[model samples]
Target: MLFILAAIVLTAHAASYGVDIAESISTSSIKCLRDLGFNSFFIFRAWRSLGSFDPNAKSINENALAAGFSAKHIDAYFYPCFSCGDPAGQVKSFWNQVTSKKLKFERLWFDIEGTWSSSKSSNRKFFESLTNEAAAIGIKSGIYASYYNWEDIVGLDYKFSRAGSWPIWYPHYDGKKTFSDFKSFGGWTSPYMKQYNGDMTACSHDVDYNYRP
Candidate 1:
């Protein structure tokens, strides 16, 4: 019984930590993060805001994998530029760049913060186009947004059909490393992961600390 209890505690702790990175870092830096208890890594696959792919994405992902992080625990995220238009094209570009480099990731997370168009309908359509394109390519997708950002960009009352089923990664930046403060938004009653801290350096690498529980 004691052994079982200890195993349960270990499992729970292992499932609760992650980090997302935009900058390129060495494999040793990734191993450092792993040593600090971050088991999951989310790397930026695209930067639509800059109208280009993240040049460092593949390298960061490769470093994480080299550090012994499983592909299943490493994922990709796309920062969409609402004004860039051609949402479908953006998705295709993201998919192409990631595949071209053979980066390993389990899912694609759509970063849904920042400025949006004045028209909510247009914003919703843009989002739908992105997800639709991702679905057509057979890649699973998720969303990363906070309640305020969702409300500002997509409206508080707006809910997508797949929002409930799609995994959500929300940010709070309270430095708590837990999901106690998450509020339902965009049809997500709970979050699959929480970004509890932002713009911090750990092990000589810049990262946003995240947790999944």
Candidate 2:
């Protein structure tokens, strides 16, 4: 039946589609996105650039839950301040904020695209400390970056030891929901998630579309 086939297609589409949100969205808008077949949501937990927490982190997470998203369907991301000394300390501050606000997430994604220090060693140390500290706190972590960004920030030759184990969420704004273009970098031969689109609106909310395949 055509109806049955459509349902199957929608289910498959939902399984691969997700969105990462930075702005605060209402519960109604969250529900709208869910109804539109977005299966997962990644929310910003903190903004390390300003050394401050995202004021809407708690509300947006609570709203997502209220809209029927579970812990497994939601995750948090942090944008680190590259020049912020003591990367471990920054992670501590991030965790503290998460606990203080009681925000629940399945994993923490490190947003790795931005200005960097002149020293590649310093940059590598910053990323290493971030993941190491996340492990210390018993929370899983992943990287959100493109091959170009990764190579620029950490250098292509320097492969991270834990890259094989840690999942990677990369970005390629080609508007296609597949990972056909992912180039191996940072020791990751493949990606766990691909952000195929960025800076777009759906359900009247600003979101970057992502896919997991």
Candidate 3:
């Protein structure tokens, strides 16, 4: 079974996103955001290890799913900032936990927050290979990063992160956040939600590319 299932060991992706504040929110707090059009935000924080990161989010994924959002919208950011083991092993563990028979997700999010010098290169290659594996399984793969990281660490000339046609979930918070992907990941909290849930939108983007026609 392990050999036949070597794909996950190859690269399927696994990263965490935000902290664990969503768990403390009012039972209805999460719904309020979803109710107020904040339906797609993740709160899965990751831990970067030696040469890879492990992402096995259970609490967050379950909470979001119970709240009524589709599994696709309920995503996590996997940060492999310090991975050293077979990226394949870590990736496999994540997939098994994430896509268990009970909960089926259509896509997984790959976050590259950057950790060490070598990590930058390792993360780049990992994501590239993950994009291919995800496609084979009929799932979407993506990389999350800030504008500064994009232009600086990832380099302006590199094209593979965005090349697999995987959508980019860029997190930017000034006043409002936007994206060409139509879907977003930030700025949904306000004075009211703050009191009720104390959780804020880590990032948000416009996946539709709406132009107000």
Query: TM-score of every model?
Result: 0.91, 0.91, 0.57
lDDT of 3 by residue, 108-130 (tens): 55655555344456555665565
lDDT of 1 by residue, 90-181 (tens): 88887888788898888889999888888888898998998889888988889988899888887998997888667999988898867788
**Which residue window of length 10 is worst by lDDT in model 3?**
188-197
Q: lDDT of each prediction vs. the true structure?
A: 0.83, 0.82, 0.44
TM-score of 2: 0.91
Give the alpha carbon lDDT tens digit for every residue of 1-213 in model 2.
999999999877665677888888998998888777685655555555665678988898888888888878788888888776777888898889889889887888889988988788989888898788988898788888888988888899988787887799998999987778989988899889988888898999789888886
RMSD of 1: 2.2
Pairs in clash, predicted candidate 1? none
Q: Tell me the RMSD of model 2 versus the true structure.
A: 2.2
lDDT comparing candidate 1 with the true structure? 0.83
The all-Cα superposition gives candidate 3 an RMSD in Å to the true structure of 14.9
- Rank by lDDT, descending? 1, 2, 3
